[model samples]
Target: MGLKSFLSRPLAAYTVRQYQQWTRQPELAQQRILQTLVRQGRATAFGRDHGLGGVRNAQEFQQRVPVRDYEGLSPYFDRVKQGESSVLWPGQPLYLAKTSGTTSGTKYIPITKDSIGNHINGAKDALLHYVHASGKPQFLDGKLMFLSGSPELEEVGGIKTGRLSGISNHHVPAYLRRNQLPSYPTNIIEDWEQKLDRVVDETLDQPMTLISGIPPWVQMYFDRITQRTGRPVGEVFPAFQLFVYGGVNFEPYRRKLLESIGRTVDTVELFPASEGFFAFQDEPHNPGMLLLADAGIYYEFIPAEQFYEPNPPRLTLAEVELDRNYALVVSSNAGLWGYSVGDTVRFVSLRPHRVVVTGRIKHFLSAFGEHVIGEEVEQTLREALQQFPEAEVVEFTVAPRVSEAETEPSRHEWLVEFARPPQDLAAFAAALDAGLRRRNVYYDDLLAGNILAPLLLTPLPAGAFQRYMRSQGKLGGQNKVPRLSNDRALAGGLLSVG
Candidate 1:
């Protein structure tokens, strides 16, 4: 079945166009989607009781149903966990993808047939864009490798526990199954001891062309493969052309990968999640432009200034402006309505409606980029960390400092809280300086002079993040430590470095 899906390019392209047409009609799409959500709510007994039955338009629906976070849907998620699809969908859900959020034990994201199609379409769109740009219909003609956690689907003991990647593998279409390199069969969750080794063994001699996954996992794969084969990665996998990565910033990790491969490989960024696939780099040459999958989502944008507004303008895809940064608010067929995924993005061009993901509003830092967010920093930080893993940061924060005197330079001050205490502070700082150079050329040149000082590493007192979370009445559950710092007082109170 998987092999059939892999080989049926014409059928795949037909399905892709069907998905794209949904987004092309901005006005009609909104009307149809609004009606569907209301109908779904009525069918599920939510609309009549709440008197939300008459939500005739998107605007009216938004007004009637206040925006809700995952915390607000705990009761609904719990019902799905008990194998009841009452609040999530109409029938028995196919599976639940486990996720950790700021205020829960674990979020059982219901993966229904409708939701699964959304994910598949999103992934297919990424591939379609690549094929269109490269003019390579047989892009997946060779071994296409994905370094996911594991392929285990159903779990016993009434618990759905595993990485999101593991759960997704079960729903892969039958036709595209052959494209997966069958090197490893062990469940990563069950066989944590040998997972990495198995991965190395599987791809050692394979002619892998397209590689995709998190930077850490991919980088680790390179290290293991190089050590096992006694050859550079380029020699081991000569067919590799496109490298797709996401989940964290690539800036910090890029230099190490380039050095290891000894050449620049084509790279693309994928903006996706277990809940849904949001966007992807549309053009190889232009990393900034991410074309929205209009068909799968009813798009909305909350301008950065109005992000916290009670009723921000939830612009349709047609209403979106070019070059303006806004947080994404989307309503999808997969049971998410008026939901903000917390990602911030800007339009590069709007004629084709392409966007550039700027940052996560929740993870913004006040620094060189006023709106500096996780994706940007992650890109640079990953490149840096690959070179100096010893400089692993347990926590970090950055703040803007005013030049007290004319002689002082205007710059952003970073207070890095490292995991391991370094014996030589200067050496630790210089290592970071070198790592940044490799990740971003501009940063490297800035550090060469006094423009940006070598980073200041402050070994934090162990358990600071845990202690801070406890103080906030947020302990003993999933929590996100602050990734970016603009609030000086909050940063100082929460963090202390030796």
Candidate 2:
């Protein structure tokens, strides 16, 4: 047997066993994770300050550590950035993953030894689940190309700082590193356009079996490959059988991506944040991903409707209900105690604990009390796009247009950049408007009452969003366009572009 094939067997078996055990007793697994984190971090400043040393159970832990967001944890992060050891996690973090901030300039999320281990193990389990479910072990035999951020890092207060993918790239196992595409030098190119060119050149002829990345970036790669080779992606990489994606909902991009691939391929969705690796799609037909209960991260859920409450009730895995949107909170090995990651999710299944990412807590529109979310907008767009098969949406954002005078009507403004323009722009807008009203009762009521005008659709010139991201110094990596904003900052910026 080949070395990789031989090694994968035992690893796959262990992952299957672990997944079964954790899913079968999710509450027990989570409790054990919570206990481990509290015990391990008891010596840290945060641990002592929060009295984590005496916290023996989930209830006690919850009572001790109040739920916090990035702003709430900023004080401790400031200490960590100044090289403070044992401030949040034990000892110093190896690196800090920099994420785009809403108010602050940036968010520095710690990456400790234990947390990195969780990241690696969670990724492994995701793949093993895919293999086990599909009964396809040959996937390990070929190269797996991951289009991610550069591995090149900058030192901040003697700690490495860069994109999470870049940080994780530095620790790729020797055996598996050989199977991953895009050389180290190419990954660190910094210029996304140039980096993509190099990636395409390097992997054009490789025996690629798996491809993983954010959907938008992956679609860009597929488009470039097809353009250069004068052949579809399936023809270029017939061995490519799986496409793993996360960071954004796949619904809007699914049709265009499938058209690029020119054939059906297995897909796996992951819910990974700078905070932690939380879940992965395990079953082939399941829309929700199975939550990773034993990934060294304690999970908590607060209803999205109550996220802004002064003291919202926090629910553990056992308490989370199916089909209810909840804002996720995590206390992990990374030393983020009761940290809100800003994402919202709804449980699809309670038996094995699976969830679908509904939207971000901050990325919703509620100007007219309609309370439209990212999921709703994306689904509405997806249904709208079906009417115009030739039109492909590359990027989009929405914002409320409040009236300047009492006589003026308020409406929702949509800025959409399309790779392929539609034949009838007005029809596209009409379809989107109808879809939203049908999906949201509040929106329907507002429109029926004439309190809001028909949604406005502005087709942006190609590369408008990209230019904006570049101008903002957030062109690549995990940075994405805010899908829905209650304010006009993002919308105005996009509209200002020629």
Candidate 3:
């Protein structure tokens, strides 16, 4: 091994050792962070208004602060965006991550110097954890491709503002700069299709070993490269070994992604957001991510079922039980307090507090009170796929449909695009419907009572979802289709193109 590779393993081992200090006793780590956050919050305008100065414990903090969504917190956010200091956190924020919101329009999430450490470290440690466990550091020797947003950032209120991925691009470790792929000009193209074309041209001949992106976007890159070279991605670049991804569920696209590569590779799953980098998968064999409890963010949870109620209990890490769904909440050094990040998670292990992202608190099927969630839909679809190996899903979404005739539209319409269509369409639909009923008790009750018809599958032409995403200007870079909806907005859009 060369100097860098020789040094990396020891460094990784040391890093993993340091990480254990927190994960092994997250309750202590979390308590320390919460106390620090309270100290910081006491100096801000929001803290004073919320009576945070007198808070001495988690119970007091919980009672003092009410849970807030973006809209509820936007008043304080407005002051920060307009160049005010000490509005939320102490002093001015270093950056404001711009993200699209379904209800709040555009959101400007603060990224303080302190909070930025959480993002930068989580990403670096993800690789370090892999090196420490696998003892393979040569993946760093070859070109690493991170399919992401433009690095070009604009100024808002004297703070750098851009998409989170673009902001993160600026911080790829200096040692890895030479190993990173897709020229700067190619990344800043903005238009995703153009960027993909340029990325393909630039990386076609390079020795790419690590490729990273949201699944569908990376799959698109693989498709274009394979089409051009008439070979599997692994053949085109045999050095390729690590696949890093986040932003959405990876299982749905796993089959197609593997098929395109023609080989298995190491995959790391990340739970990231504009708010904070919450967790990352350490062990590839398991389906859970190690929660970043001490990374300048204090976590709290409200049982997912009680989340919509008037006053939901905010439970600490020590109080959370395993295998139960909870709406994940956070109070961070970024100046966001009692922030409901719209994500729901289930604890798989409490020893180190590993969690699986179950679904969004808002993204569910409840028009007829069926309460079907993303996890249920995705899991049901996976079971159905196993029953019919000939069928392959490219993309899919579920939306409720309203109809006058009982024989008309099915209550839950599943819009799907297939890479390999099933020969027995009726049988496939029956399997999916049955699997869903088995998973969701609410859906099963509705179906049995005849209050709702069985789910229906509407397969579209190949690349229809791609066309839809492209038309909506959300083709790539941290965007994914909402998996389940109570309304027909997404369903209507899909039907128009299908």
Candidate 4:
């Protein structure tokens, strides 16, 4: 038998046991977790801040701490990175994981040693999930390629240089000193510079079996690999068995990726962050499971429907009801408490706490499984509009709908309001369609046939999102334009009729 089958066979018993426990006794599992977090909170920064928030302990955690978005902790996060104790949390944090924010900047999120342990635990769980699903440890053993932000530390020797690169330098993990592969270059890029070269050098003649990174990079890497090898990836590297990815949706690029690989390759979806590894797919086919790191974090769920509601019910990770959609709330060793990560999720089942990542609660879009998140869509649109000397995004909203009810499958429509209407709307829309198709195959297929009609960019009046913000009386503090909204209603009633 090949390595994958061999490894999987031995681990079958353990995987089944964990699966049973995960699928059964979810309530008891939650209660057990609640008791653990109550104790951890008392020892961590979140517990200390709870008193100020009027939460004396875990029993009163809900009452004491209110839900918070990332903008709420920006200042405190800055302080924590400077090695200062933050008012938002209990203690002095050790390191910061630099990550890009939705707005026009990168964020240095605090990551304590305790939270780092959580990250490792999350990583182990990731391994367990792969082993369980594929029944193989060889996929874990071979040379692993991580297309992630570099592990380089920012220097504080003298004059401080500030740029996206410099900010990224600060977020390198302390443990990277001992953990990273020796062959991978020590110097890495701030904006994916030298990406193609680095990938070629590190992977060539290497025993790489699994690859992990953001979806775009992976797609790009595969494309480059195919070009260099002059054949599909299967011919270049037959040993490759698994592709693990996170930080962005994989559904969009699924088809092209499968075609490039030229065979069925196991995939694992990881939900990770600079803050910590949150959740991972427990089984390959059953969406992702929110395996509670009872020892690491305090998780809370706010219903997606009530996300913008002034008074939404915030359910602790353990108390969370299954088969319902909710916004993820996190409290960890990092100074964030009751913080909303912005991603929205729906529970698939509870015994093992499996969930489907529905969309981002903030600026994001998911029309017909394209999963066009804010940053990704923004990047694509920015690149496409660069060609249009006068084109500017005044505002835009994507809504999933039935373009033609008579059609067997409904398609998507993006209602976009431009700052300066494009000189050629058809060309502009076609550019976006091309980018989306190249980036994701599902959309490509949808467009090739009429499953999804040609993307229609409906221009709206200027100041759309801004107008919605004003009407909601939510303008100015730290709000960004919503990228996607359910077709039921205009997001925050932000769309102006064209």
Best-performing candidate as measured by lDDT: 3
Candidate 3 per-residue lDDT, tens place, 164-274, comes to 988999998888887788878888999988889999999999988899999989999999999999999999999898999998898889988999999989999999999
Ranking by lDDT: 3, 2, 1, 4
Residue 129 lDDT (model 4): 63
lDDT of each: 0.62, 0.89, 0.91, 0.61
Best by TM-score, which number?
A: 3
Q: Point out the worst 10-residue segment of candidate 2 by lDDT.
A: 1-10
Give residue 357's lDDT in candidate 4 (0 to 100). 68
Cα lDDT for residue 489, candidate 1: 57
The runs of at least 3 residues in candidate 4 whose Cα sits more than 4 Å from the true structure, single-residue gaps closed, are 1-49, 52-59, 86-91, 155-182, 191-193, 317-323, 364-498
Whole-structure CA lDDT of model 2: 0.89
| Ten contiguous residues with the weakest lDDT in model 1 | 473-482
Angstrom error at residue 70, model 3: 0.8
lDDT of 1 by residue, 291-366 (tens): 5544456667888757877767777676788767788876665665566777788888664566766667776654
Cα lDDT, model 3, residue 181: 82
Can you rank all candidates by TM-score, best first?
A: 3, 2, 1, 4
Write the residue-wise lDDT of candidate 2 on 1-498 in tens digits.
467766777777787887787789999998888888999989999988999899988889888999988999999999999998999999999889988789777899999988898777777778888877887767678988989998888988789999888887877778788898889888889888888899999999998889999888888799889999999999999988899999999998898899899999999898888899999898878898999888888999999988898889999999999889999999999999999999999999998999999889989999989989898899899888778888898899999999999887899999999989789999999999999999889999999999999998999998898888878877767788889999999998888873
Residue-wise C-alpha lDDT for candidate 4, range 86-119, written one tens digit per residue:
3434555455555557552666666665665666
Query: Model 2 — TM-score against the truth?
Result: 0.96
